[model samples]
Target: MKDRLAASYWLHESQYAAMSSSAVTERRRAAMERFESEGFPTVRHEDWKYTSLKKILKAEYALSSPFSEADESETLEFKDIKRFLVNDIDCYRVVFINGRYSSWLSETTHQGFDVCTLGSAWKKYADQVEPHFGRLTEGLGATVQLNTALAWDGLYVNVPAGVTLDKPIQALYFTTGEQPVFTQTRSLIVLGDGAKAEIIERHQSLTEAETWTNAVDEVFMGANAHMHWVKLQHDSPSAALTQHSVIEQKRDSHATVHTISTDGKFLRNNLDFKLVEPGAEARMFGLSLADGQQLVDHHTRVDHLAPHCVSRENYKGIFDGQSNGVFNGQIHVHLDAQKTLAFQENDNLILSEKASIDTKPQLEIFADDVKCSHGCTVGQLDEDALFYLRARGIQRKEAQALLMLAFAHDAVADIQHPSLQAKLHRLIGKKLGVDMG
Candidate 1:
């Protein structure tokens, strides 16, 4: 693994060196050094205890490179790619194929606000990219550093002060190839004071070939800003994904993030939120549906650093077959953060005897005037509800599916986009082998 990574670094050395002697280049070099020293995380790490990378580490994966127009033409067609997209909605779309940006399939804008690629931003607007590029991810873990060192291209959005985007921005990443491969993508979003925007991010594999994606995102919200972000993970069963997102909110800002994972062989998500100023509010919601031999894990942390701040976290999971699920949520209140209110809850449903889940919700309070609480539950479905549905002239399978959907209703309801929410409902129903109608 180290040899492959070293070769990749040298292969892209020219590209990295061409960025000029700037802070971004220095940060990239530092990240490369850190990843080289720490390497990939293992079960020995406390946060990674419930997840393992034995299989992914052992498999040989080709690193992604720039794709040519001919390669794109031979890889996929718009007709086949449209199925992975959400229809009946107007969105600024940014598409990437095999880790390279596809301008032909994208709809970007820079008239009033910025909706473009990180590579372009780095080349064209270095001043804007330098200040906040590597600021939030300084002491993050190894995988994030790996992404910083090797990321080819990703979405970048900047909403100016008091501006509200008319439609959401959809960032879609699709993997298509005949060989086992890996891709690292990075994104950054900045919202000025009183700005508002909605963003949707999705990852999908167009083929059954083994693929691995390591993605990282950093978001900064100015005072009085509002942002809604959603992550939908529905890759092929032969694919694996690891993603980390860091969000910072300023005074009077509000942010909400929803992560829904339904398909993959192995998946892990790390989400961190920092309330940097007074009156900040944050909400996080997650849902994982694991079947077959899949594994899904989520680790989240919310930090309350200012007075009069509030945060709420809720996560739900449904496991079937021999799948496994894990959830670890933590909320921390600083010593000076008085009048802080935080709550966290995690619940799971095991549908098969072979299925399993591990849930831990934790809270740490340092201020005397703070209110914080956390709870978790792991159990099977309600027998009474199942019986009631079965007796009402419904098949057992459909009844179970209906009950599962109802169980997940709260988390799905938090989604603000109507079209995306409807699409998720249909996908969830299809995954459970039932008609949602």
Candidate 2:
């Protein structure tokens, strides 16, 4: 009976009956075949060992169709949140409602920046699109394949070379609908040489709608370019999200990724980077706080293919309830990549025995005369520290909140924007159920 049920479940999710464009038709068909051959990736998969898909693929869920009416105001704008904070960012805004682009909610930029749907870009930039589109994350995994097959529309941000916009481009994906849907949204962000920009990508849900969102984004930081990318994923309890961020760094480019994940029934993230030229540097800062029966996972790889490159990574997690968290980080140093300095550290704190974390820090060094180190630490709150806070006239709840804040400070401090940092601190305080001055 178990085998029969699992097989039926896999077939339902594997259902593919439509296509919107023939842009990547051949590649999409090949991906569908790969999904059929690979079947569903269970705990047996190396990267998914800590997560269980039995609940997500139970054969009873319905796939969400193309959204005709996705209310952005009813979904993403929360009364309790500072919605005005998102108002001032200058770059063009593209909003996706239930996996489909919502033209009513999003408008095109008049000048300087070009914001269009992925399908349109596929038609317009046909020659240039074929090379970079769907190329970097081709061989990732089953979820990625599923995204490639089911994705109908996404966002494309193209900044003319040497154009520096004062505003940060924002893309918001709302994943709330009637049924548990699996949707893929792709982004191709191109920065011409000496371009300067900031981007903030927000992913969230409107209702407690059960759904699965598989998203992918490709960022090309041209030579001497600077970018700040923020990915915020905090949905309802009945949602599952998997996102892949592939960043390609050219000569003298600096790009930093700040990831903050708070909610979701299940979550997995892959942040892969390729430093293709000398003097390229990338820093990845991530934080996840899981409560309830949630399971959050982060898997990252930073590849140093060229010499004189540097990469630094720091990821931290705090869990309560029966939540489970996983962190797997790999730093690869290739041959001829001399003077490569890389550092990676993962820290996890579990507040309950039922809540657990599994962290693994992996390093692959094939070159000589390079400095690289990776480490991870998992533990609980310190009682002595708690007592110290109490002795200092801090209440119990405040003490826990204070400790949690302190634990996440390193990650929070890395945010490039002070407003963003303040917002994150407020959100973290609320999620931890702590109110402090």
Candidate 3:
């Protein structure tokens, strides 16, 4: 299977060579070699013990081709496309259909900052993208390497020093085709020193056909830079997605990431952060709601390499029916990372007897002056809280929804954007079959 999949990329090698820079071509070749050697990860792998890729690997998926004139004619209805967009937001939009950028459905800028596709960045802004394009994925796993080798187009944003983007940027990837296909995408976000920016990412499937997405993101934060990133995953049950995000923070940089997973057949997210200099801060929050034999897994790691750095992580999960959820968080404070402060918490609620969760929060503190702690809990809904809400004349279903909302409020409240927060609340309410108002 590994040989067959690796050989498939040879079909696109000529196209990739023509479109990509020499540096990118070399990186792709190296990544493909690495993937060929490592192959797919299995349950035996410690990092993938709780998740299985048997079904995903068994299915034959057609690789997406580059966008062309014919693809322009395959259009979707406005009403259908509008449902996936965030309403009432004055933000720049970049939309991708079938793993290809859709210029008609996108709004991008290149005047002050770059809001464009990775292919364009590689060709037009080679000087700015070459250094950090594939630097962060040096030691990543096989899935990421596969993406690096086959990924054709994705979003790219660069914020210059001391400049704050006037509005947020949204990157939407929509899958719509006749047959089941696999799409690989890679995104790069670079923020210069003292720069501030907010980015939103989403993956949605327009058709019920089985589709798999393998994506990788690399974010670089310069000294004193600030970034807020939100990822929304609410695709159909036939959609399967695996995403990995690598974040590198310099001195005094701050970054916050929110991952909200409400729907999908199988979802696996790997979030890794590295604090390269002192005084850096990293925050991670995640919420997952799964039902009907679905699976959602989150693996996160934070590395403190310098002194006086801080990191915080909180993740919550709600599983119904026979669904399964997993959360593994690791915090490592190196010997040189003195006076570091780190905390991690993972809490889960099972709504049915068949529902299950596996949570592990670990902390490794090698610095004597650092303070670090980690904890996790898995349990059912709070019966007492549900009863209280029922006693107040709320219906049983409404009361359950209210309780679940309250349980997830702590993480939702951390979102700094009011519009985005409100949108998420509505999405959560819709998923719970309740009215948040």
Candidate 4:
């Protein structure tokens, strides 16, 4: 499998290297070398101790690339993909089909700010793309290296100082092909000083052809900038996803992230926040519903490199029917990061006897004056609460669903958009087998 992927990389490099800038091509070569050396992580790796990629690595996957020609042979239209989108929302859209950009279905703009593909940014705005692209994820995990080696097109949004986006931006990626394949997506978001933006991202498979996706995102927030991001994950049962996101904040910048995972065969998320300046704040929330032999893993890290920074993390999970879930969160405070405040928590409810969860929340503090705490819990539904609802003439299944929804509500409570929040409520209700009106 490694040999085949390496051959594909070389073939792409031989054909496209001359067209790209030397600096950009060098980065790609270096990243490919790193991936070749490390390959994929196994259960023996420390960061991946609880997760195994044996099933993913053992299968044959065809790599897709482009050299000035469209690789999409499947015909699609806006009506064909309308159902996968959020209803009753006015937002700018960016859609990709089988790792290629779909210009007709996208409504990107560049009037005051830039909202387009990373490939376009490389061609038109090299000065802006060179400084931030591949900077945050240069020496990270093997999957990140692999994505950097091949990904050429994805979402790119650059907002100028003192300007706010008119509406949220939606980035939708759909996989469709007859054969098993792998795709790479890399996105870069840059916000100038005092700028604000909101973004929604989703990935889906249109067919049951066994698709795997590796995505990487790099976000840079200037001073006093605010950014909100919502990620929705509910792919087909034959699909798998691994996403790595890095957010860097300057002085007084704030970042909020929400992750809702309801369905998939395998899913893993790695989120890292670097508070490089004082008074920066980071907030993260996640809710996961796993069932029927599914595996979901979430790992997060926050580094307090400056004083007076604050971070908070909360994640909830519900597992049933032999599913397995894992959560590992870490908060680190440096010696110079005095007066840092950090809190982390993870709670889970298991509904089946065969289901299980493993959660670990850790805090490492080196500062003399800092307030930090971490905790986790793994248990079943509250029997008393279920009984109380059932005694009011509610059906037993309905009562259990209501209690579970209540437990998972806090993770999505901070969302600002009513339409997006309503859509999430419906998705949660569908997963829980009840109507959450």
Q: Is candidate 2 or candidate 3 better by lDDT?
A: 3
User: Residue by residue across 189-266, what tens digits does model 2's lDDT show?
Assistant: 777777877878877666565776778887888898888888877777887878888988999888898888887788
Error of 3 at 76 (Å): 3.4
Model 3: number of backbone collisions = 0
Backbone clash pairs for candidate 2 read none
Candidate 1 vs. true structure, TM-score? 0.96
Q: Judged by lDDT against the true structure, how good is candidate 4?
A: 0.87
**Which ten contiguous residues of candidate 2 have the minimum total lDDT?**
12-21
Q: With candidate 1 superimposed using the best TM-score fit, by how many Å does residue 117's alpha carbon deviate from the native?
A: 0.5
lDDT of each: 0.86, 0.76, 0.87, 0.87
Candidate 3 lands at a TM-score of 0.96
Model 3 worst lDDT run, 10 consecutive residues:
65-74
Instruction: Give the per-residue lDDT of model 3 (tens digit) for 1-437.
Output: 57766776776677777776888888988999999888899999899998998877776676676733435324766576897887677889988877888888989998788888886787788887789888988789999999888867898999899999998999988888767778888899999999998888998887778888899999999999999999998888899999999999999999999999999999999999999999999999999989998999999999999999999999989999999998989898899999999999998989999999998887788989988888888887788888998899999999898888878887789888888899899889888878977
Task: Give the TM-score comparing model 2 with the true structure, all chains together.
Answer: 0.89
Candidate 4: clashing pairs of residues: none
RMSD of 4: 1.4
TM-score of each: 0.96, 0.89, 0.96, 0.97
